[model samples]
Target: MTNHIVERASARLNESTLLEMFWGMLLSRRLDERAWALHRQGKIHFHISGMGHEAAQVGTAFALNRGVDYIHPYYRDLALSLAVGITPTDFMMSLFGRKDEYSSGGRQMPSHFSSKDKHIISGSSPVATQVPQAAGLAFAIQYRQKCGLVDPNDTSQPRLALACLGEGSTSQGEWHEGMNWAGVHKLPFICLVQNNIYAISVPLESQMAVANVADRATAYGVAGVVVDGNDVLAVYDVMVQAVQRAYSGGGATLVEAKTYRPVPHSSDDDDRSYRSREEVAEWKKKDPIMRFQNSLLEDGILNDSLLHDYESRARAEVDKAQADAEAAPLPDAEEVFGSVYAPLEEQP
Candidate 1:
């Protein structure tokens, strides 16, 4: 049997792709910044920064089908959600817990993003739960010979489910269960482990034996590879192959992206209790936004002026989105009972 060779290359991104990636990263970053501000201002209950994971999210999104494919994204994957047709307004509304919020019926706290219209499943608060759900959704598609939540004969092609998680979630039973099932069934799914080296407060050394979570794929008889998660183009290339492999019946692939989390786990947690200032400083050297911007500049795709312009635009847009969200009316108290399973009388 021949082995597959999908190299994780760190080459220049196409000029257009570089611009698009930069713009996307800027939007994701600005959104996080404003969301955090909202939390501080008492406008939002909680906030999570997708800061360091922007490369992994946006790059992965560029590699998959947006409206056609399904994405079982975790809370930290705001960039992925945005890239897959989730408007800034939608995300802001979700963050503000307003009536316009599509994911939660205005009930879920901020960061739990979803879009039924785009087939991006609403992520749960339970850790690692989405891993198995993604594989299960993929298996159902193959079993029914069609896509779920849509007509079977749409000819949109059988979409793959890309589920991402924090490296810490890999310690859970659901991770192994999802990987094993995908391997056994040759399901069209991709499990991406974002190894940011901290599970809220627990360090990576305490979580897994291997340096890379990708190494664990050996147990499931699947291909595993690690890429520079801070390198957007590199992540993009790997995701491209992973998505193509799954769509072409090559089965599941596990990509362990080595990244860092710039902010504390959430608004409530203080990272200083567990991590050293020196450690955070070290990780800052690998900042995804800076690295990706350098990649673009070195490739002659962008200059400092262009980068600044894009970021300014993104920041302004984020401000507008936040303002719109704050101005939108909150969901009425009784409306909470609306979307949950409908009325008992309506059930057959």
Candidate 2:
């Protein structure tokens, strides 16, 4: 939470890792902008963005076992999905509600990310619902290890469950119950609170009395931590600690990443009424992508040529994904309830 603390936790990141992080951040930004463009053109019905939260999400994602750990990501987690190996094509398919998309097969709303190979659990609209689901999954992992179905001695990949949400969801009963349950059982769980200071339209102060969401972790008996969400390196450093602790059977942790959302909550909401243009502009100057780019330049890891190449690649990737999704077919009305019920032979 403090500058001194951050320096102490900071790890020496190599050039390769730094470049990988930059590429991930770039991919996320390109896809996010394309989504907004589609929405403005009336090509999509609704869109929620993760513009200001890229550093926090991408940094946390790099610390996990990419496809092995179970991740339950909330809405506004487009960056998180992309960072964790969910292809731009998969994201576009879901945004367009295409029939072949793996996440709900175009039945559910967009931003509910899911991938069978990646082990990403599809999220719902109800706030904090994934909190309990993540905890339950952690319990299942614990049971599997205990039953010898999963190797507890496997140090290469210590499985865990991650629950991601906005700071506002911390007030929900499900959030409290889930965190408490995990703490009681010492489940290998991590609760990531991307604190962007608002619950739809309500400010952080109005929604909760505490100064920081991480402050409540004490009551749950889990380790509480806060970090600069805009600083990718800082967030990654802290996540390294949390992941190691979980792998070493250190139980659960609550990470409150302080961030800000510069865009409107969604296409349906007008941000002008609730926030000031000056405030948004001020936050824009602290854009995580630019800040990281500056750092890379200073470290000699990025140059004008490399920057241009990365940008061009990212744009092309997004362009191809958009074309693919737009050309794909939508779900059929005849199969509205296709996967809802089991067939007679499979039904007990």
> What's the count of clashing pairs in each model shown?
0, 0
Number of the predicted model whose TM-score against the real structure is largest: 2
For all predictions, the C-alpha RMSD in Å is 3.0, 2.2
The TM-score values for the models, in the order shown, are 0.92, 0.95
- Candidate 2 lDDT tens digits, 193-236: 99999787899989898898999888998988998899888888
What is each predicted model's overall lDDT from 0 to 1? 0.83, 0.87
Q: Which stretches of candidate 2 lie over 4 Å from their true place?
A: 1-10, 155-158, 342-348
- Cα-based lDDT at residue 225, candidate 1: 74
* Superposition TM-score, candidate 1 onto the true structure: 0.92
Question: Which residue pairs in candidate 2 have backbone atoms (N, alpha carbon, C) closer than 3 angstroms, thus clashing?
Answer: none
| Per-residue alpha-carbon lDDT of candidate 1 for residues 37-125, written as tens digits (9 for 90 to 100) | 88899988888878899999888888887867778888798888888888788889988889958888788877787877888888888
